[model samples]
Target: MATDAAQPSLLLPEAGGGLLAALDIGGTKIAGALVDGGGTVRRRARRPTPAGGDTAVLGAALDVLTELTTHQEWRSVAALGIGSAGPVDIAAGTVSPVNIPAWRGFPIVERVRAHPAVAGLPVVLCGDAVAMTAAEHWIGAARGYRNALCMVVSTGVGAGLVLDNAVRSGPTGNAGHLGHITVDLLGEPCVCGSRGCVEQLASGTSITRHAVAQGWQPDEGPADAAAVAVSARRGHPVALAAFDSAARALAAGIAAVATLVEIEVAVIGGGVAEAADVLFPPLRDHLAGYATLPFAAGVRVERAALRGDAGLVGAAAIAGAATAGAR
Candidate 1:
């Protein structure tokens, strides 16, 4: 268990250095950043994700913290926040990520708090989408909007909802798993044991699958979405079609969410979002077809302005806000 000072200060406030350490745990990488109270990243580091086991992942996180705090200028970290892949048990400080089997039932919060460098710091946990949404609200695309949705499209699709100036973390902190939504009852299987999920049809992985099915052979055989995007730009018909499939699938998910929540804007992020023109135009067109209701119409679809660090920054925001609330 974390020490008293490290506990969430929901009732009592403490005045001290407000440096916050934020970590974003992804399937392929573990990214960390040291953020000041004002939400500026002071230092950043990353490591290829460890596939061996959860312990190895924790080791990598500790190694990152050691590197960041060892630098003389960053010793005043006041809290730690982790924005991790869901579904996470925020109250329990545990994670059972659907994609990372090794993380099932892992006590991530305790493991992180046990680190010597940050043992006495308040710690908060949130799903990646929610954290990213918080980051966007703080300094990214949703900067001025109190009601918005931040969605990420990469290896998989996920989202975070913000309404009335607060992130809706929902019960168990897995509120925004848009990727798992069923887009096609006959689609491919997802890592979550679901068939025909939005991720199965629209994720980068799906783009690769569609391209392969179209008989577009890559130099090394089956290629990922990024490779397909490059091929599409270079006049590969199959690749272009794959992009269209992904856009349509994603648009379906976005339309569903937009119609349900009526958010003011939906900020899309993640690796695949880099193919902005190839992806967004199709998404907008597809969405326009389905957004017939007045409430859902006029919902803007924009790119996430936080770049790749949105998760980390959002984690810091969660921790900072939680700590302040505890105060």
Candidate 2:
């Protein structure tokens, strides 16, 4: 977790002078930003996550947060919000991300509250997928929808639900965690101690593992999902098969979600989603077969609109919700 002084940027008002501090904490990176009311990102900083140490990782996150304070607009910041990799406990203000094993049940809310520069403001927490759902529902692809499911298909599959016109992050902040849902109840063992979960078949990590195990190799670097995507585009049989399997699994999971929540849209984003040309067609085709029920057939699948900014925008939205609740 090595960091140098950050170059700060100043953000004036886009719509209003109301500003918020936002943080997006994942297993591999921590990003912080100052966002105004209009979804404008005024300033941002990122720090690489350190491996295997809770204190060091928290220090890296704090470094990113401290960088946000260097902005000229810091004085007007009204609240703070964090979208963290979970399972997060909103009531306990703690998180225990499987990727960040050292932080079992870590009390993140209390620690952020103690940071002198940003303390005293209301701090909010939500799972990363729920945060993304909030951002999309607020201004991105899900804006006009009354119900939706938004997903991130990166190192693992994660998703959240918007039901009855609000993000349903449920108690303990782990609701709408679509990855661990058993799509193939008798298929393969999942790391979440479940069998045939969508994450076991459809995540970027799983895709990469399947490709390599089937003898798909890049000419150089380790064959990740991105590499597999490239090979699939080149018409490699094994690569294409991997994507087909993953896409089908993803479709099954989406169909299940639609059946349960009655969502109108399914928005997807993340590194793995960058391979849509290889994944989307098969996903749509498979979805038609799985979503046989009348209520679920109309669910429209879509690509995420905000891309990299979604996480920060979503974090700000969480804080904005808190600010409104306090009124």
Segments in model 2 whose C-alpha atoms lie over 4 Å from true places: 1-16
Residue-level lDDT of model 1, residues 194-283, one tens digit each, is 888888888787888889988987765447887888888887889889988888887777778878887778899998899887888888
Which candidate leads in lDDT? 2
Q: State the weakest 10-residue window (summed lDDT) of model 2.
A: 1-10
Superposition error at 289 for model 2 (Å): 0.9
Q: Best TM-score goes to which candidate?
A: 2
Question: Clashing residue pairs in candidate 2, if any?
Answer: none
What TM-score would each prediction reach against the true structure? 0.91, 0.92
Once fitted onto the true fold, the runs of candidate 1 whose alpha carbons sit more than 4 angstroms away are 1-17, 219-222
How accurate locally, in lDDT, is each candidate?
A: 0.80, 0.83
lDDT against true structure, model 1: 0.80
